[model samples]
Target: MVSITSTASLANALRKTIVDTQNQMSKAQVEVSTGRVADLGLALGGGTAQDVSLGVRSADLSSITNSNAVIAARLSTTDTSLETIATTAQNFLETLVGAQSGAGSDAQAIQDNAVSGLKSLIGALDTSIGGVYLFGGVSTSTSPIADYFSDPPSASKDALDQAFVSAFGVTQSDDAVGSITQSQMQSYLEGGFSDLFSASGWTTSWSSASDRATSNRISLSQIADTSVSANDSAFRGIAAAYAMVADSGVTKLGSDAYNEVLRTATTTLSSAIGDLTRLRASVGVMQTNVSNANDSLTAQQNALASQIGALENVDPYEASTRLNNLTTQLETSYTLTGKIQQLTLTKYI
Candidate 1:
């Protein structure tokens, strides 16, 4: 036995054992450090397929959650714009009520405030993000609201001028406008002036928004309305209230005609205030839905991640213990190999 187990042969055997122990130590160290199996395919076997599937689902859920964050931001901005429009309308409504007495000091103030309100409305409706117009509905590329009082005479201003002249056969600033009767002014307001803010009219001049808003898939089985348009009736009513008061010859009208304009505009504004409130509420609901969907999606993602971890992860303590054992074994093999190589028949004799 001693002859057969020669110095060279015994050393070779220890060398092989050392190499195997080193390989095992390397793998164990990796598993301990990573908290996951170093060879998932080999460790999990047929279960690797399920691990891959779970990983894909978890990744998809995470992607959707990220996407919903963007959607939530857009909705938050939309809600803010809607609130601004509603507040503008409410302030204008209060101003209109205060000026109903038609005081001299109040007249210019009313016109000035109407001008400011129209500007506010236009600015809010024209709100954009990332080159996409939020109020453009699905027509995100275009500005939704036109500048009604543009100096060069926007399409809306030009259209208003034509409608006013056609209805009364006189320009708004003409002295003849002062001679206009209340009934005549009322008819004009109800007819042509009203038409100027109608859906078709607004589309032709004041707005380029589509009737249908943009929608996005928020989850695998759900979608959300991601935008609102300037063409909605609430926006139309608000614009009309401002236009009739600001542009429809208020500065040139007789007392009766002027009061008639105020009465009509105040009524429209009051109703529009309610509508604008409801519009904000609707957007709020969308915000809530997005939040809930994201919360649910995140929870699902965490659950899927846990399942994936169970399949791929290893016990770090167990791996660490195995690593220590292999290290000791490797060291012992090196020592044994060195000692065995030094053994010689001549030295023993």
Candidate 2:
């Protein structure tokens, strides 16, 4: 038995073939122009799993890179502020040494410079970057140090005033403080002055910042401390030393008493410089670590990008060639479809 085919059925089949060929040509043109598969699911089919895995890894690495950038910026700001404080401390130390050597023997002038240096140190420790206080430890929003020039003076300044009266039975600038024994002054320095730098004293007198350090996530599994607080021993020592010199009672004391205070201040300042230098070195090490991690992440990101491109990206040259072939086929199919539509039963008979 022979099978019979209808002209209408043949025409319908030709029309469907033309539509399918035109769709293929359109998709090929898109691939040629864009240099990427128009549909990943349709293009790669089962091979899309690798692309998905690589994309997830790339996104994770990118997130780590962004975190590293933010940490690096914050550390940079911290380093800068620490550097400024170190420079100021060194200059003030020189001034104290000069005073000790009688290079600028005016006690009042030395006292004034010490006062100014103390103010500068406070300002530096309270420095902020992007509305976040760099020296506030975990308390980013709070200023770390109290303002010494506030209406009633800061608690730290008030403590010094009270200590002066208790030790010498006179106000800071009164002539009676000049008559106090060197032994009494030394006692005050070793006992009372030392207390102001202690952890408890710092809380009561100088700072309200957190004792906890701020930390940042720099990598997939690593966290790093990102800031130093005003309560650091180095900062406390600097403040203490300067506060001694800046005290009105110390300045009004006789030359012997004033020199005693300067000597104590000089020793504390020297220790502070050493501590701050070490801290800056540590910050430098952290910076190097973050930079190295970023470099590694960049390399990984590049490799992942290449892997994704191999899986999903179209080759322009190959796609363009295929597009031209499809275009020719589509033209032929259109001509064939038109001829099929014009077919008649008389012609077929």
For candidate 1, which ten residues in a row score worst on lDDT?
100-109
What lDDT score goes with residue 149 in model 2? 67
Cα lDDT tens digits for candidate 1, 133-185: 99999999999877877788999999889989998899988989999899998
Question: TM-scores of all models?
Answer: 0.88, 0.87
Candidate 2 has its poorest 10 consecutive residues by lDDT at 248-257
Q: For model 2, how does the per-residue alpha-carbon lDDT over 1-349 read when each residue is reduced to its tens digit?
A: 9999776788788778878878888888888877888788888889888788889989999988987888889889889888888888899899889888988868778778888888899889888878889888999998999888678777888887787677667787787777877778889888877887898999788898888888876766678877777888889888888888887575667778778888899999999899888888878988988988888888889998888999878989899888888788878877876787787888768
Model 1: CA > 4 A from native:
1-26, 102-105, 330-349
Clashing pairs in 1: none
Alpha carbon lDDT of each predicted model = 0.86, 0.84
